[model samples]
Target: MKIPFSLPVIDADVIAEMHDTLTNTGWLTSGPKVQALEKELELFIGGGNALCVNSWTSGAMLVLRWFGVGPGDEVIIPSYTYSATALCVMNLGATPVMVDVKEDLTIDANKMRMAVTSKTKAVIPVDLGGYPCDYDAIKEVVNAPEIKELFISDNEKQEMLGRILILSDSAHSLGATYKGVPCGLVSDVTVFSFHSVKNITTGEGGGIVVNLPEPFDNAKELAFLRVLSLNGQNKSAFEKNQIGGWKYDIIDQGLKINMPDLCATVGLAQIRKYKNELLPDRKKIYNYYVDALSSYNWAIIPPFKEGSTESSYHLFLLRISDISEEQRDEMIRVISEKEVGVNVHYIPMPMLTLFKNKGYKMADYPVTYDLYKNEISLPVYNGLTEEKLHFVVDTVVAAYKTISGN
Candidate 1:
């Protein structure tokens, strides 16, 4: 009766696809199936060019590197997110200026504006726990004429600098929506994770979706950048096979982060089931959790902002109001003892040892810290049967009552 936080729901189709990929002719890397998955992701997530990568971390790093974010530049990110969100910025030798999160656990747009300075090159807003951030608010902050001018030396340079990019860490929100537009379309550049726990499964894969303004050929630029990111090779496995195209050039220094066709096959199967099949099942579990916990005054349910109907429902993050961090830990322990495994969504990035050693003060982000202290991620994947779902909910209620002395 052990219910884990999140588990990949795979079946015969996923196994069959993977087996077929293993038996297929092309298997080196980035073959026809990889390209096809990229195209399908682009179409599935609406208008944007999708580039498959080995991981979302690589996708974020590639996008930042392609956009000229480097040493002496600063990228603003929420303190309340997985380390990968900030690690990508650090990987480029750039600074990650941590910002606070609002009560809803998404980055606070106003704080993001205050964190901007001459060195600030981009703003990365994370869709924490599958909830879409206020994209319009973030865009307005990044697109402000005053903010744009601050990054450049003069009006002439301002025009040359281009608008500050909104690179979204949409790892948790592939199917999420904001104001009728999909989450992937909300930011200038969005990266989605297809890890075992994400809405879709690619074994271990991710994709980058870009939406840029004119004067920038994001698709072509990103395509070349993807090549550079993979190995700096002029041609991928698919391209090298073309008649007389075997020999290619190594254009720039790059990292090895290309998705194989075997992974893409799993992605293809998962993507097909995402819209019509898997999503509804997740939504059902989410509603059940909400309905079961509706009467608890201490429960602060995850927000599904108004006008946002297409959430991936990746994780159900429940915040225990007025609870200390120690109590939260104890509650998790109690739940685990009952065989209903629960976990925390994340610890604030600033609280991590690396950031703390680098002089990132956690007290600066009180709201973000508050959310981190109380947050608990409940089980909400496709594998949960109706009986197990109810058992998880009941265990949570029992744990809360025991911990709070209610």
Candidate 2:
């Protein structure tokens, strides 16, 4: 029996929703379904204005672009996160100042504070492994008088906020919460991915919840971003289809990153069952992994919740204590040979070829590499049979035992 790493939560409801969207919904691209998805997401995360986009990268890039992140501008990000976080900054011709992460794999708040500079436009903190970062601490860093003073606003959007933008890369943390509040409400703007492997899947889509503080109207900003996502055209295809609505003008040089109704359909369908059914089910699996593995001498189970912060149960990142990078690789080989698929959450950005050649030294981020070397992400998706779950646990145990000879 081959146990895969992760799977999209595609049940009957998802299929039915997609069918209705493709066949019944007259507007396919960025229409009613997308609007409904945005509304549902907004309400689900409590009350931030959520906007659906083509992808997480697009949504985040739109935020960076709105803030006028360009050549000479620096955006702080954790070296432990996915490449998209840094790629969004680099794609916009801005520099990504990488920092180490905490034990929980979330960006280190102190490291982030030190990375802020006069040219710093934004800080993208990644909620790695479906867990929310220490948002309260991160907020303090960005809200500090020194950090605010160091920020130089070059665009109207930045000037309006008058501080460093905290654009959360919450790709793994939609249902996650910190301080009893959802991820969206903690950051200035939180971007969630609906990639197949994420907690929520929309084939390929993203949602952005705007929570920019006072003196800045979030609704107005959301409206402007909608136009920006539609390629500078003031009128969308759905709007233009209406009577005499074809007459529109190019507002600015914008991007084509609007979410289609079809993709939004899946996200909406899944979200309807998220809080009560889906999230709890994943959390059950995460808890089971922790409970079953906690007693082992070599196993180092990652925390799902600390203080008031809780994970969305995205990935069960179980670390093998006292293991070298090479031993971890060997353990993975043994697990794979047993047909139980496992994966590393990430190979820290600095260790990657793209960043390594660009002067990003892995040694600089010690915490990130320390976690990366021994970590192994297990599958935590919907519809894992009881048998499969036990099989996975047994396989991992045997693999580790085989490698450790204990």
Candidate 3:
């Protein structure tokens, strides 16, 4: 019953893929395998071209730079997300307008409307715990007449979109859907994480999907991103090593953030098993948690389905009713002593030191803090069995009862 909070699903097949890659290819950095991974991801997403990068943070930074989100610009983001979402904005010397989230733990569209000003360049709606944000609603808010009138275009990409950019921070949700539409097709641009703890893993990697509408060619953007991922070079090392290809040009000064072939090899192996094994197995664990915890009065389960939308079943954010933050901590401690693993989804940015120093106040975002105080992310991974799942639920319930003096 010693369950850890999460673990990567790296089997012998994945290892063999890496070994095969090393044996067959001498060029490891941003080579054919990276291109192949991007192609496979594009196909899996059903539309939109994909670009693989070393990490989601790097991908986000690339998107910001590509869109020309720099000094004096403001990028809106939810307070209840990982710091990377905001840090990426900061990296470009832009201001991050921290906003609140709704009960489902996604960014509140109404708050997004309130946060927008003439200087607002973009809004990054995070898919917390693998749940897709309400892109249609967010788009509507961004396209409102009042807001649209204030928009000042900064780059060619920004002018083509004709409004504020909806850059989705979909780090937790890869295979998720909204109204039967895949994540890659929901926003103007979407980013996915393949971190070790994410649903898919590349040891450490991420993907970017360009979904800008008609008049903006996604293929051209894909090519542009490939160049940007390397140091804005016209040719990758593999291409430069080819016959008479050594002569190349520097397009622009870009960051070095391309995904290496070694990591892409793991991504390829995981994706092959994704639709068949990884997704289904994770779904089973999620269902088990819901069924086991349904009878508990304090259990507030995470939302996996709402109308035609479905989560990728990334992390389970379970909330405890009427519990103090101290009591929640005590319960987690008790569960850990019993060898059942649990964790918090996030600590609101307003409560963190960096954001506090930036003049963000926790009191302003009551809903975000409320969600963070009582939420616990339970053990949900690839190989968790029914028996281990039961132990997890039972341990959590017992710990709560003990801590609450019920």
Best by lDDT: 3
Candidate 2 lDDT, 1-406, residue by residue in tens: 9889888887899899988987887778888899888988988998989889989999999988887889999999999988999999999999999999998888899999888889888899898888888887888988899889888878788888889889999999999988799989998999999998888888999998999999889998888888889888888889998888889989988999999888888888999999999999999889889888888878898878977789999989999999999999999999999888799989888888999999999999999999999999998998887789899999999988888888
RMSD of every prediction: 2.1, 1.1, 1.0
Candidate 3 local lDDT, 146-172, one digit each (tens) = 989889997788888878999999999
The per-residue C-alpha lDDT of model 2 at residue 234 equals 88
Writing each residue's lDDT as its tens digit, candidate 1 over 1-406 gives 8777777867888888777777865465678778888888888877898889889999899888877788888999999999999999999999999999998778899999999998888899999878889888998887889987777432332244476778999999988888788878888889999887898878798998877776657777677777776688878867778788899888988878889887888888788778888888898899888888878888888886566455678888998999999999999999999888788889887788999999999999999888889889998888788899889888988998999889
Q: Quantify all predictions' global Cα lDDT against the true fold.
A: 0.84, 0.89, 0.91
Query: By descending TM-score, how would the candidates be arranged?
Result: 3, 2, 1
Task: Estimate the TM-score for candidate 1.
Answer: 0.96
Candidate 2 displacement at residue 130 in angstroms: 1.2
Query: What is the alpha-carbon lDDT for the whole of candidate 2?
Result: 0.89
Residue runs of model 3 more than 4 Å from their true location after superposition: none
Error of 2 at 388 (Å): 0.9
